[model samples]
Target: MSEQALTLKQSGIRWLWLAVVIFVADIAIKFVVMENMGYGWSNRIEVLPFFNLLYVHNYGAAFSFLSDQSGWQRWFFTAIAFAVTGMLSYWMSKLPAKEKWNNIAYAMIIGGAVGNVFDRVVHGFVVDYLDFYWGTYHWPAFNLADTTICIGAAMIIIDSFRSEKKSD
Candidate 1:
């Protein structure tokens, strides 16, 4: 039997589906959070000793960078997220289907980026709910999108190292 060539749409499409799933889940959870929790620091529910569900609007990037700015950061971050999502989509499309790690990483990044972008466009800030802390020290609250993006980034880093090791 002869080997058949797969078209772009037939290849690496599963990764795109994963991206869609992530996007949907992210949006849905955010909606639930918005519906149940009050805006800002009003309605906080402690879920665990080191975790809480709190509503926070971040008008800036990670760790609320530039969050104190005069509101220009909203559009700026929205634009950046859109651009990154676009780039990651393009990159994912170009990858071979067998490159599972890279595909998954790109899809996750794209999904997370789009999720945050939607928040910025709709609410003028990203909605963050998950809060983790230990004693008096608290990690900045973040959402599923942020968590997925960090996981994807870490996977990409690991993939790079694996590739380098293989090449050696």
Candidate 2:
């Protein structure tokens, strides 16, 4: 293979390591929460005025959408996660090695997707904790995978604007 081709391939593989790290961390943290924390909201352990370690099982999409449905949502979301991961992998492979921000974003997304998919496949739901609240209101509980996905999405948005500004 050409030197350029070899370099690109190596770069792609290196970027994928970030995904693997995120996936492992997400799974490990979830496992710890599962082992130490009790299930349901009644067992929340307050770590701060605005934060708590809580356990929640989300059977549907973000914010528990369709969680009330029969049960098809589990497989549906799982399939979606797999599809997204595949697409991100392909997209990352196509990106230039110098596009660090884009690659990082893709890696985070792929990792997070895999993490959630694993949970859905094994537990029939996404295991969530890391609760944040304010006064009488509480944000929907989310795990590291969810946080990584959101951060990745935000990074992508920021990179898009930066790219646009550079072109202008």
Candidate 3:
């Protein structure tokens, strides 16, 4: 194998640790929200021109997409979650060494994906909260895991652009 790849394998502690941290934190927060908030409990608080805190539970994917599916979807989504978690974990492990930011980004994505997967396995669905709205328009409710996934994906994209620039 290449020297850089070997180095990455040896320096993977930080990546693994970051994933553990994000995963633990996500679990703790979700537990608190679930235990305290109660199912479907929501409170509205306008913080911006178009924002509100509306607690919500999600039974399916983004925007309540496929939320009304029959019982079969649970196992299907569980399988999907397992596949995604494995792929992301492998990707995180193979990240090049010294790419701290890149590793962090990967760790965040993997952690968040696994966090939601845990929920899917145990509860058969992900629990989403934090609602935003603008008059009659509303964004889908999401949670910390979702936020981390989005931000990590953004960082990955930004880093890809930065790498291409450097290569050029």
Evaluated with TM-score, which candidate comes out highest? 2
Per-residue lDDT tens digits of candidate 1, residues 82-114? Answer: 888888877876777788898999889888988
Top candidate by lDDT: 2
For all predicted structures, in order, the TM-scores are 0.92, 0.93, 0.81
Candidate 2's TM-score reads 0.93
Off by over 4 Å in 2: 1-8
What does candidate 2's lDDT look like per residue over 1-168, in tens digits? 998678667665459889999999999999999999899999999999999998889988788999999999999988888898888887877777677888899899889999999998999999999889999899898999999999999999998899899999
Model 3: per-residue lDDT, tens digit, 1-168?
A: 997667657664447777778889888888877776646634545567776544566677767778898757666766776786677666766665476887787778778877887887787788776777778877888887888888888998999899999999
* Predictions in order: lDDT: 0.87, 0.89, 0.74
Which pairs clash in the backbone of model 1? none
For model 1, how big is the CA root-mean-square deviation?
A: 2.9
| Stronger candidate by lDDT (1 vs 3) | 1
Which sequence of candidate numbers ranks them by lDDT, best first? Answer: 2, 1, 3
In angstroms, how far off is 167's CA in candidate 1? 0.5
Give the Cα error of residue 112 in candidate 3, in Å. 0.8
Supply the global lDDT for candidate 3: 0.74
